[model samples]
Target: MGETFTGASDPKTARIMAFGDLFKAASHRMLGFAGLAIALGGLGGLIVMLNAKPEERLLPDPDLTPGAVVDVSLEEMCEPGYAARVRSVDSSERKQAFRMYGLSNVDRRDYELDHLIPLSLGGSNDIKNIWPESRITKPWNAEVKDTLEDVLHREVCAGRERLGNAQWAIRTHWIQAYRMYVGSEPERFVAHSRPGF
Candidate 1:
């Protein structure tokens, strides 16, 4: 029965045999791919083992600490439309404007603080960081201007972190002022109303 079709197989039998061969070839290719994947994985593991330090390998990058405050500068705070206001402006205003209208420190400075990141945004209240500018200019200040960018670009930079302590302090003072003047709900206190670059 097997010898009967040895010389010339039927078309149906030939087709079936061809399909079986193709199936075997496909299975071999799949197994080859899996083996290659495993080999590459092992090689990668070996490479990592050879070069990686024990502390550096399993642990996250030590330099990459979380919640680190991004550094900003006062000169970087000033944009074309933005200007620093006198830090004293908040305390010096006439009673009519501050007491009656309930003006923000930035507003009292004519939106100068808005041209810079408000103390509310973790910015400082020093003269370098604070500026008195018009309300139209407030929209242009960068909320988080990078001093590093200026330095990297080799621009003439000034007063790095000079205002940080003052800024932080003034921000606290501003929060207190808001609570005193605006009766809390201090989120309504608008310091960053202007555009910053």
Candidate 2:
């Protein structure tokens, strides 16, 4: 015979060709999936960076008084009537806060005399607990801080978080705490209850 011709010539050759095609298809699919994963990961990182709030680097007044014994517990602050009383902001105190932060020339509407550690988390009314947080700031404004305050208070009241730790977290690095709770920097300051409130 001159030459015998079969589609695959032999069973072994046919099997090898089939496996090669299958391997090529599988590798192509895997490469596509890997590219997609890499693109998605980069996008996620970009979104996080865009939404991340910048740290304010604010420090509470060192000479000011700290939380006193009478106002030391979250339980005491969480009481409806007590919370209301502590939340009160007299005009003089607000002005004093502005002065404390050297913000006398700044517009009052542009900022809030925020408590360094919110009263809802058992922060005292002392000057050390107060600061002038700008509302004009992108993500870490007084309103954003207020949202964190509410969440932390709820956690403390429910025994899911320690009151002392909540206070310390805000005092130490509120922007970081905000990122952890909000999952991104705030784009605007809108007061809405977070999940698990």
Candidate 3:
């Protein structure tokens, strides 16, 4: 992971470049990456990064998106409207995310710049905590994840679930986490899809 790349001389881009953008912006910039250790995402009963294709990868690389968060009391995190009050991801950051995923020309409707761990769970708006979750993909798209997020938020606020576990679920395998917490059809959805379950 010590091996790194440099990116657009712009100070901001330097901080935002990711694997796809590194390749897509080859003519213009690069960025450094560390913590190559990956968290698992599953498909078809096996853990892999978005079907295991690097260029086609859909989920955030744990090395790039480790789900940043800030320390907050459960009460603070669980307050109604808390996520809305704290949520903030600018347009430029959204562009950065699409570029980071090598999605320069994709239809905006096809994706949502999303938080890995939701703001409701104390997730930060840091570039490192966000990714372009698909709006089109089925069985494991952003909408489905939203259901899981709401469930987790309720669980955490209810004192029935630990905040850390909710955070961990988003980072590791949400599909699996969904089974345990969301009480949905396991067969209809699953993917360690960036630690779903």
Candidate 4:
């Protein structure tokens, strides 16, 4: 027959058994709370990542020359008719700029020889200002940039934004402006035209 023990008969053993049970319960609760904390932390990180603005991704143009100057003045280029005549470069010049940027074989149809600082904002026509902007890859393509150019042109002409500052803003980081105004990067090229050059 198995021995039937009572707390009164073996007080020390009873206390030891009770202590062990209590310890086990505490250990389980601690582990559960720790796991929950880790899970919540992971969820918080994912939420932050989802809510934050996407980083601006762009390919660097290796052919950009430092301190290259544009010969044209803002007043001359900012006029309504000036962009058509002044901003156009010859095919050989375009090809040369493309070659300098290591994009020799790229189809001209797929990219625009974009000015880092647009002519309307007094950006130079020099090779330093030109890069092969991808129509497919860039968040803000040539068409979108045309809109930005017009906006800046209006601001500059109206004396709302300084021409030098506008040029610098486009040259320094055009992507940030694109993100600010456009909200997000387009998944693909959106074809639309604005009135006036």
Model-by-model lDDT, in order? 0.30, 0.56, 0.62, 0.54
RMSD to native, candidate 3: 12.8
lDDT of 2 by residue, 18-65 (tens): 543444454444445544654777756444433432441232332342
> Could you tell me how far off, in angstroms, the CA of residue 132 lies in candidate 4 after the best superposition?
0.7
| Candidate ordering by TM-score (highest first) | 3, 2, 4, 1
Instruction: Provide the lDDT at 165 for model 1.
Output: 31
lDDT of 2 at 93: 76
Task: Point out the worst 10-residue segment of candidate 4 by lDDT.
Answer: 1-10
User: Per-residue CA lDDT of candidate 3, range 16-99, in tens?
Assistant: 333334433431211211112132222322332234332234456565676688767788888888999988999998888788
Better of 1 and 2 by TM-score: 2
TM-score of each: 0.18, 0.59, 0.65, 0.57
The digit string of per-residue lDDT tens for model 1 on 1-197 reads 01011211344234434433444454444445544655777757445443432212211111221111224443444433222332233544343223322234434544323313243223334333333323332212222122211221222123322333323212222222222222333232243322211
Best by lDDT: 3
Answer with 1 or 4, whichever has the higher lDDT: 4
lDDT of 4: 0.54
> Candidate 4 at residue 70, lDDT?
57
- Kindly report which residue stretches of model 2 are placed more than 4 angstroms away from their true locations once superposed: 1-53, 57-73, 187-197
Cα-based RMSD of the predictions, in order? Answer: 31.9, 24.5, 12.8, 27.5
Ten residues in sequence with the least summed lDDT for candidate 1: 59-68
